[model samples]
Target: MQFDLAVIGGGVNGAGIARDAAGRGARVLLLEAGDLAQGTSSASTKLVHGGLRYLEHYEFALVRESLTEREALWAIAPHIIHPLRFVLPHVKGLRPRWLLRLGLFLYDHIGGRKHLPATRSINLHRHPAGAPLKGEFGPAFEYSDGWVDDARLVVLNALDAVAHGAEVHPRTPLTAARRVDGGWELETPHGRFTAAALVNAAGPAVLKVDGLLGEAPEYGMRLVRGSHIVVRKLFDHPYAYFFQLADGRIFFAIPYERDFTLIGTTDRDHTVGEPIVASEEEIAYLCEGASNYFKTPITPADVVWTYSGVRPLVDDGSGKPESATRGYRLDLSDKDAGAPLLSVYGGKITTYRHLAEEAVDLMAARLPALTGKAWTRSRPLPGGDFPLDGLEPLKATLTARYPFLDAGTVDRIARAYGTRAERWLNGAEGWQALGKSFGAGLTAAEVDFLRQEEWAASAEDILWRRTKLGLRLSAAEQKALADYLGG
Candidate 1:
């Protein structure tokens, strides 16, 4: 195959760049080594926020950019991105309440926060969120962020890229690439392809990809491992908690899957390897961190699931892993000569759209074929063509239209696929028409949709990345679904 641009990696950054470039009239080919979002993209804290903590690091530009994109992302993909309130209890011995207030003040005003509510003080004893907290926690501050289906966000980007004429190839890793006279020849398992320009957005393995050309950059990347643990629901309320530790680190206890609480994120350097799993120490640290705030203590046994991802962060010479910057840098090799190669560095999920736009803008200067202007700022991803406030109404419409489906199933499908749910249902008049249910409202029809459309190749892709049905399905049922998909 031949294309105008071949984008490496299928994480958010790579997928986003492919989508933007393809939409701008560039014939794009996106290749991924595994299922989409099988890396750091899927293992994020799943919060779309301005990074209130980043203010402490004096990353005003990053904070502003992220705060700006937070709303823009929600506006475009409202089904997967929804407003969430974060409760920060003013624990003594940590950063003082005054610093917290000032940081929040900057957070509220920095990026032009309009629709989301501003920060306000609340008495922990009186607030519903405090019901799960310890007695000593008195006053707390509540601020707005957002919850996201991180993995789904990636798949949706790839879907939109395909919709816009890009060829997306998951499970196909780029084996090698050599710069030719006018373009480059790239190798994958399937076949060889040529492209006028190349993009290396390989999340954690970006540096490795850059090394393939026998050229090395001066700067290095720090592989920081962040891990999360999920347990039975810790609270009944909708608000998520931002608990501060005595060591000056912070973690979150957010409601997950309606029946569990999600807590995580330790910042330790990690050696990249296959099957990144959370260490026992990391799990214990997270449990202890949450136990310090919640009235009820937590243990490792309570954890139903754990996930870890290695972040390829720019090595800014920060002494601590958590202190590293999340901002990205776009490096263009052969900018003034030869075929252009753009390699993307560290970036956060919140700023992926801006990153992609900037990447394409940089590449457009070199690629004469890329004539289209910036347009993704307003274009909605696949299934995200509806209004931001229309999620519930759309859900109601789906329930009404598919009267045979239970309300819960309708809501789940509506949230996952948005208006595109209709496309998947495709005039299925009844449950039987939808095919057999493999538990958790997952049916043969939906599995077919995933395989045919979303590049889902395995049960792990469906249960863990495409949806969190893994948390709800039994081991036997999950195996059955896997068997069904294999057949």
Candidate 2:
């Protein structure tokens, strides 16, 4: 296939770029080596906020850009993204109270605060979030951020790209690419194609792709692996946590799926090709960290599930992985050096849309066919047309229409598909009409919709990426789902 732009990854950056380019009238092709978001994009801390700790490092621009984009993203994809309050308790020994207050003040003011509430001082002993914490934890600060269904965000961006005439092919790896007379020639497992421009958004594998293109390395990468653990709910309240360890590292413990609490993120330096599983040491570190604050002790045995992903951070010579900058760099090939090739390095999920917009803008300068201006900033992704505060109403509507679905199922569907839930639920009058049940509210009809529309082909793609039902589905149920897909 020949196109105006070809994006070479299906993670959030590539998907967002494809969506933006295609929306602006460019013919776009998106190729992914694995299922969409099967890598770093899905394995995020899953919070959309300004990195408050970054203030100490003086990453003011990055934090400001991320903070500015936080609510903008929520406005467009309110279904998968919503406001989340974080409780940052002040420990007497670490990060003094006045310093915390100053940081919070800057965090509230610098980002063009509009709708989300401002930070407030609270007594941990008096607050509902304090009930599960140790008695020693007294004063705390409640601040605003947002939570995201990380994997689903990638899928939705891909879907929106397809809606705008972009061809998205998951599981198709790029084999080769060479600059040609007018543009570039590309090879993949499926076939060969040509394009006016090429984009390398391969996350951690970006350096490998650059080597394939025979371009000298322009930047060093620090592959920092961040791991998270899911356990039974730690607290009954809706507030999440931002805990600072004495070792100068921080992690979060948040309310996860209705039945679980999600805690994470250990920042350890990772070598390329290393297994991206949470190490026993890392898991213990997190458990010990959580136990320091929570009244109940946490251990590896309490961990129901663990996930890890590497952040392809630009090597800025930081002393620790946690101190590495979350900022991004865009390297566009020289104009006289043949066809334009853009390589993306070091970005976070919270600023993907901004990164994509900037990427497409760079490409537009090289390829005139990319004439359309930036439109993703305000436009909603697929199934995200409702207002920012409209989730409860949307859920109520789904419950009223599909009375047979339990509250858990209704909330899941409404959040996963938003206004698009009806696309699968339209004609089913009852559970029987929705086809066979595969446990945990996953019906055959819903599976079919995912397969037909969202490029889902396997059980892992369905249970894990398309939805997080893997957390709840059993071995037998997952096998049944696989068997059903195979048959």
Candidate 3:
């Protein structure tokens, strides 16, 4: 059977495309070479910000859309996504105060923002957010944005796409695709797909897809590698910190998932063949950039985790990372304009929904028979339908219901899985009833649910993708889980 749309790559843009298409009543199939979010989506700076600094670059449209979505995403997924205030401490001899103020003023007005609080100025010497900052930096400005579990966000979108009748295949590679009479014929490890339309959201490999379809005009994607690092907790406040470097670039240091702090995002021009590892140069760059602003300095030894990804940007002929545009571009091509293939380029997590709406809306003009309208605007994603202002009540209820389960253990599962966490906890009379412990929150039941429902096929899928338990698990524990999952 032919699908209305076949989306390649299972990262944010592709998953968002599948979910939006499926919701819009398009028969959709999404394919991923590896697990969903195993690439750039999982390796983000993890801020759903409006890109406050982008204002300086004069990207108004990109800033406006992302700022608007910041609140929209928060309202829909309060459990997995929440509002975070960032402190941008002002330093002497850097971008002057007037310029920074102008940037923030525009940043505040750019997006049709509502839920999040607007920017405010605070004295660094007196405020708590300033305690960690050096004496040279004085008062700072604070603003609100959203923070999210970037990996799990992809999973939730994929889950919603599946719930909406889209076929989501992970570990399924799209080896080849060929244009047919009216659509395209594509092959995967599992089966073949015939689709009326194709969405080449292959992300970093989008250029490769262009070559697959016989290189069309303006067919180029710039691969810029960005890396992130996580270290032992630096401060107590939940507010995230954005520091301006000497090079006019900014890096983030956020109070991460409770116990640790997450910092990073270095933009360096790189090739795909290069190992996506944090080099000594990058580690020191991030460490020094962050430490220069903080009272307590950190070193490579303090880093607990690190990851990298390549952003697939449309080649705009600009070489500098700061000047490179963040706005996305769509090149819909075909022999005839009516029935064409859509190739997506340069999208971020913040603007994904709007991007999907625009992509499918354009496709609908081609096929007027396509059913359904934009429903994702108000609809909740999978388990995100839980009713509450927060997940604390649900966490409390889970703790009470599963008295036999440890408080920390129940909280972790409940928050991560929400109403569906029961699939992991159901009728377990005691800790022993939950089955063998796999260390951390790696229970036998959770692992089973991951494989059965979330398309987890390996230890990396379970440990890194499904859960951040890898952050807490010792090497021995990780190895044990790997060995067991391998068998």
lDDT of 2 by residue, 1-487 (tens): 6799999999999999999999988999999999999999999989998999999999999999999999999999999998999999999889999999999999999998899999999999999999999999999999999999999999999999999999999999999999987788989988988899999999999999999988876899999999999999988889999999999889999989899999989999999879999999999999999999999999999999999999999999999999999999999999888888999999999999999999999999899888888999899988899998899999998888889999999999988999999999975789999998999999999999999999999999998789989999999999999999994
| Candidate 2 error regions (>4 Å) | none
Candidate with the greatest TM-score versus the true structure:
2
Each model's lDDT: 0.91, 0.93, 0.82
Per-candidate TM-scores read: 0.98, 0.99, 0.96
lDDT of 3 by residue, 1-487 (tens): 7798989989988998899988878889999998999998988888888998778777888898998888777766666777788898888888888888888888888788766688899888887888777787777898888888888888989999998889998889888888788778998778898988888888888878777866473556677888888998888977898888888888899977678888889888878789977788898899888889788998888898888888877677876965677789988885564346888988888888888888888778775535778777777776667653657888888878888667667666765777778777887777777776788757778787888889987888888777888888888887777776775
Candidate with top lDDT is 2
lDDT of 3 at 468: 82
Q: Worst 10-residue stretch by lDDT in candidate 2?
A: 212-221
lDDT of 3: 0.82
Judged by lDDT relative to the true structure, which candidate is superior, 1 or 3?
1
Q: Report the Cα lDDT for residue 101, model 1.
A: 93
Q: Which residue window of length 10 is worst by lDDT in model 1?
A: 210-219
Q: How many backbone clashes does every candidate have?
A: 0, 0, 0
